[model samples]
Target chain A: MFKPELVNTIVDAHQGPDGLLTILHAIQEEFGFISEDAMRQIALRLNITRAEVYGVVSFYHDYRTQPVGRHVLKLCRAEACQSMGGDTNAAALLARLGVDWGGTTADGRLTVEPVYCLGLCACAPSAMLDGALHARLDAAGLENLAQEAL
Target chain B: MRIYIPCDAAAIATGADKIAAAITAEATRRGVNAHIIRNGSRGMFWLEPLVEIVTPQGRTGFGPMTVADVPGLFEAPATHPKAVGLVEEIPFFAKQQRLTFARCGVIDPLDLDDYTAHGGFAGLAHAIKLGPAGICAEVKESGLRGRGGAGFPTGIKWETVRTAPADQKYIVCNADEGDSGTFADRMMMEGDPFSLVEGMTIAGIATGATKGYVYIRSEYPHAIQTLNTVIARARQAKLLGADIMGSGYSFDMEVFVGAGAYVCGEETALLDSLEGKRGQVRAKPPIPALVGLFGKPTVINNAISLFTIPVILEKGAKHYADFGMGRSRGTMPVQIAGNVKHGGLFEVAFGITLGEIINDIAGGTATGRPVRAVQAGGPLGAYFPPHMFDTPYDYEAFTKRDGLIGHGGLVVYDDKVDMAKMARFAMEFCAHESCGKCTPCRIGSTRGMEVMDKIIAGQEPEKNIALVKDLCETMKFGSLCALGGFTPYPVLSAMTHFPEDFSKAAIKLAAE
Candidate 1:
């Protein structure tokens, strides 16, 4: 939904070998997700094909092609959290939300995604709500947070 | 009066920012004039958002604080409910030697004056005087090795890069710390960014590299922001860019944000990512020293390895080298994580036993259950049972047990852990993260997961176990990089140390 001028402004700001990543990041920051039209414009600006842009976008976990919910919940599933009952907590959270990994709730209030680690392993079973991390998360704590997010 | 609270990602994750604001507001309301310095974590993560009041006695600690408790903190700073006595006296913080992290929680990360006042940049100043070879020789004398898993002598690597003839050599800092249970790099970068900036500048001076790139994972947004700000500030102060500090040598650095790819933590893969491509592992023969980062000779070191350089130079190589045991000569920032009660960052000399780390320092599992196993290193590291806790944290000692001191991340597990499931998770993680460039890592991981599932399902359990062993051997010997190669360490070690857990999984399936 971005205007052509705004798209061009973002694309024009980057130069050199890192232009693609820079352009994509700027676009994602300005807009919620990368659109197909944006990809085409990026391809044209960077002198690469849309397929290459798509490949890069899909490969990385952080880039989203579609719009997301109001709140993004990233639950850590790495070894450190796993050692602290993250699996059980992850399962409970997913079941309560009625969504799988990377799925958004029906009301568009929350989206639960699986992240490898958030470096809060010392306070294990951590989760990040819209980029703010919460550690030592129990079932109750998570449920309360989820309700608050809703 | 002065007060300190962490603005580190780990601290911020636990609401450190909110706590700082509350403290500021509370102090104003109470008509108390106080200076609030947002420092980094002391590594006592359990006491996160750990606030300290600089009392005459010392930096008195009050922790795990929230907004609600801020008002009370102003009323009675020392006698607050969250007060845990002096920070240095707390058993968790008292029992460790912190070298690279010495200024972590003590100084304002963004303040150059604070950093200089705290014995920072002395290394760079010394390196400028010593010249390239002198700096390299001192590092050699210090016996410092790469803190990022490989344990290769850092001085030797620098010497190689220094000798390599390239008009456009580069220094690539591998900040893509993808390993689970490892946050030392992130913490260091977020807490003390100028240290890294100084270290890389020193590398540029020693190796004659005029340009550098710090490739950090996108997951660490806070670290990226911190580093960007520091790099700009350093540039403004002439600590970086053309003719740094009025010296003839010119070096500049840029921060490259990486998309999530565990394999990119590998040096060559990081270079590929830097070049705006998929992070597939490259074969080594020419080595990164001869050819790296768009085929130019490059000096690629992990964040910790580079960060340690400034200290090595400032303190004199011998002084830093005198701290650790054997060839692993220096302190290690061991992250005590997972189920541990007082899990935090404990930087100690080499040769500290795992038993002491888990029992004495960490205070055992937070769940109050008996420690079942401890996974030292990261996902690729081996799992050690309770009996093996006597093994020291030295590089060679860990290698002797088929374990790696990879990033010095230690994750503890309690009695409820299932070895079979943990083994499966290793393969699952590898399969997901594999770049699909090598056969063993790409296909073998999926096959290993299938075999593990069969064993758990009790379908020819004995045969499945044998198949897993055979598969792991192939993946170990046949894989191109550590991602595929070291995945077996966790899988095989779990099955070897905790065979009973595997048997129980199969037995339960059989009973069903």
Candidate 2:
């Protein structure tokens, strides 16, 4: 989706071995996601094969092969969160949205995911809605928050 | 200068991003230049929203910051009015050894210069100078044990792999860390990716392995992303390829994401996952050291165990061996979560008591309720009451008290929790998550859940109670690995420790 010049600019900034991932991330960020063209280009530029580049992308869970929604919702599934009825809350939310964790909704309004912990154990149940934290939530709390936020 | 803000899930949950926004807005309102770089968390949760101002004195720390405190920070850039002193001086970070987390929060995570300035790969440089035997001897002398569940001696394990005859060897890091209330690995990897990379490289050097893989769980996306970035960076720098640091030892690493399978945290299963097969744990007569990863010798290690190696080299093995009690040696990074007020990462030597940690350092629960049980380790770990609070938190010390030191995750729960429900939950969790590779874990867990249900239901009264206890005994002895074996810890501990709760819940349900 990037103009050829923007991609070139990002590729130029991608320097050094230590910042290789950051450079690739920058390329992806500029184009909304890493395109096959960019991956092939990176492989050619770095003197690595396309298969090797694809291997790195496939190995990591965070790398998105497909473009995602604008807003992200990550619910905590750590013990603290689970102890505070996170299981039930998550089930209800998933049921309501008809989208599982790591799946984008049909409308592309949200992308839901499960994170290990948010370290807000004092608050028990917690979730990040579009990079904002809402803590001490129950099934009702989650429902209301997700509904109102959207 | 651009100010970096932590966007790690933990920091964001504690409102770190908002604090960054507040600082930027306040700086704008006051006509000051402020750029925000959203990075990973600093590993300390209590000091979350932990903002750093890069000054003449280095990155000055201000923590547990909310948006409300932004006004005060903008007024004084060097010495913030609301900053909680310097992060270095703070006891949470200062008191203990931070070998694995050395460069975390102290340097720009993506910036190699900052990493080098903070003494990042000096250990690798030293390892290269000393060579494999020296590195092996150094680790063996350090008395470093696996920080994961087993607490096996790391040096011996590496030596075994080093001596083993195989055309291809592998260094597999078990990052599928599914332990509850433990985020130390995630935090460490996110904040300081280089330390893990350095540790893995050291393992490769010691064992003569050319390739490495970190099998991280799918649940931790941010950590995966961070590690991927760092690995690419290392490979690009020629530090991960054909000749690492010109030492003529080839090493490369790649991440293999696990699909939310708790049992995959076990080493063999992790290897299987790396091979692009279903994650099924293999039995250990040969051990992974002998026959592993396409029948090649493999050096499998937990993230913490791997990360601790650089320190063993940087400081002498004797220095590392000088800390802790009994067989458990060196400093441990204790992660206290759930209900605790001052919940954060506390790195302490082995001998610290559970009581001091929960009451003093944690400041008890945020709800101000009386803490009933403390689940040490993970879901499979023992639930200790106040009486056991005096017990020491270490590997061998915990075993003496019939408890586990699993990944050092201490989950605190209040008085309102029902032990019967907790016991049932444990059985249910085992039944749900068990990989079904072995018969005991597969069938025994399901049986355990059903019996626990009968006990709660008061079906046949005394008979059901006896049956549940007997089932727990069967699971403990008959299971192939720790999956089904350790599930009984929670069930039995809850029943033995809090019999009153179970009796009341059962009786109440019967009456109803």
Candidate 3:
């Protein structure tokens, strides 16, 4: 499903400043995650080493090397959320799902990740499920969200 | 009938979209013609999904509206249970000065006509008449500092880029707002994007830089989408492209999305990231003003600082400068968040006390608990206990007390918070987000966390606390950037202000 030619096209389109990050974003947008083959293809087209590409990919928290689940839930782990009992709610959700931080459920339906902030701090205890944001989540709210995602 | 509903990310998070859909369905069923416009949030977040019906007087408000309240909207808006009079009359909105966010939540963000009608491009138009030197002079006169943590004079930064001998210069708007409680950048971009487009164009004109890039954080997908749409629209309308408004000035801009890296918020690190490298901090002496972004002179400013340009140009320097106290001039869109009730963005002049902001403005803790500690600024900022609440919200005032108003965000905490755990989190966060460019930050933060863990475990508390103090000193002075430098503020502030929380005896007492 990961096409080398599509990677070439993405690399070609972003040939100027910020080309590498743009290309990686495009590749990730096309596929669920950036594979070694795709990174190699990108490096070849961009005239950079595979290690250089990997360094960038590894540096940013957004870039994933492996495929994600059907739903990716990003829970806010910042101070604002912490003040609103986000730690307890997050712990409860993770416990209910039986997955650690950055872990995917056994059913392959949900993957939970910790994000520092989403700029929705006014409504603390925020989470983003598959790009749509949910906020003001208590323990029960987080549980119901995880259950729905699972 | 015309209806206004916020499409802001915060509003959407709290089910604004569902309420909008419910209102539409209910209106259709009743055979009533209703027009729904997705506006930006008014910063009164507690009352979000704050539905407004256009009345003869003004936009009459009703919210935090639910789907249950939708049917009543059409029946009798005046008698609706959620009705809260006119939107402008709300105390939270009416009390403060709203310059930077003047058009936000007021106009349809994408509509150029709507933007123009709301006095959007007047600054850019005025900048064309003033010329580059005059524009710089006006900014210098205004005394506007960076709304980002540093509080550097914006005029001087532009003057550097303006005079620097470079055939090709650049204007970069730092929209990578990574601060936890801050959302002014996101709100402005999502709400009134053209203001940024216009402001950046003004910066380009003032600094003699034709090319601009708004480096936005990828977490704000909606803001990115909104900015991109506005950029394309501005281009099509001849506002951004060559010979903008036929003034013989050609300036254009693009949105560059940043991957999730907290250090990328730093100007030098941001430049490195922009160049497709690891976002490591570049040492100073040939600061980004001189050898920046592909070895050319560049003017980098925070999104808020740049967005405020138009108003300064339109109203003149003194008018904008007169609002604030001391060296800190102009209004800051202070984001009050976390455990507080009525938590939202309040754009007020500097010198308002933190006590007023938390207790009076924010209405204290949402859980009805006593306010314990409040973190002024981002993760890197120092924590202020309630006793220190009288300190005015000025740059010098906060810095005098060992805190910085980094990005104008205040994350409040209730009495239930454990200061020791919060202190550990500061070190942990710094270690997690460190760029690994310098040893003091990279290694010191990890060591600090470990020492904190030891202190928490009641294992040689006095020795570990001393070690942490030493580690903090190294990180504070020796680190490459603010990420490591300011991490000590919260840790030391906690230890000093809430000593009982850090003591093993207190922990034992609490347990018993």
Give a tens-digit lDDT track for model 2, residues B276-349.
Answer: 44456788878998888877899999999888887777777898889888887888888888877777777788
**Residue pairs in clash, model 1:** none
Best by TM-score: 3
Candidate 2, residue B231: Cα displacement in angstroms equals 1.7
Summarize candidate 3's per-residue lDDT along B233-268 as a digit string, tens digits: 999999998999999998999999999999999999
lDDT-based ranking: 3, 1, 2
* Candidate 2 RMSD to the correct structure: 7.1
- Candidate 3 Cα outliers beyond 4 Å, as residue runs: B504-512
Worst 10 residues of 3 chain A by lDDT: A141-150
Model 3 chain B: lowest-lDDT 10 consecutive positions: B501-510
TM-score of each: 0.98, 0.83, 0.99
Cα deviation of B399 in candidate 2 (Å)? 0.7
Across B1-512, the per-residue lDDT of candidate 1 in tens digits comes to 79898988888878888998887887788888989988878999999989998988889988889899888777777578998999999887888888889888888899999999988899999999999999899989988888889988988888899999888999999999888888999989888889999999999999999999999988898899989999999999989999887778899999999877788898887888788777788998879988988898898999999999999999999989898898889999999999989988899999899999999889999899999999988999999999999998899999999888899899999999888999999999999889888999999999999999988777788888999999999999999999999999999999898888777766887687
User: What's model 2's lDDT at B147?
Assistant: 85
CA lDDT, candidate 2, residue B62: 78
Candidate 3, residues A18-123: lDDT per residue as tens digits? 6899888999999989999999998888788999999999999989999989999999999999999998889888887899989999989999999989999999
Candidate 3 — what's its lDDT? Answer: 0.92
DockQ, per-model, please?
A: 0.74, 0.17, 0.87
In order, candidate lDDTs are 0.89, 0.77, 0.92
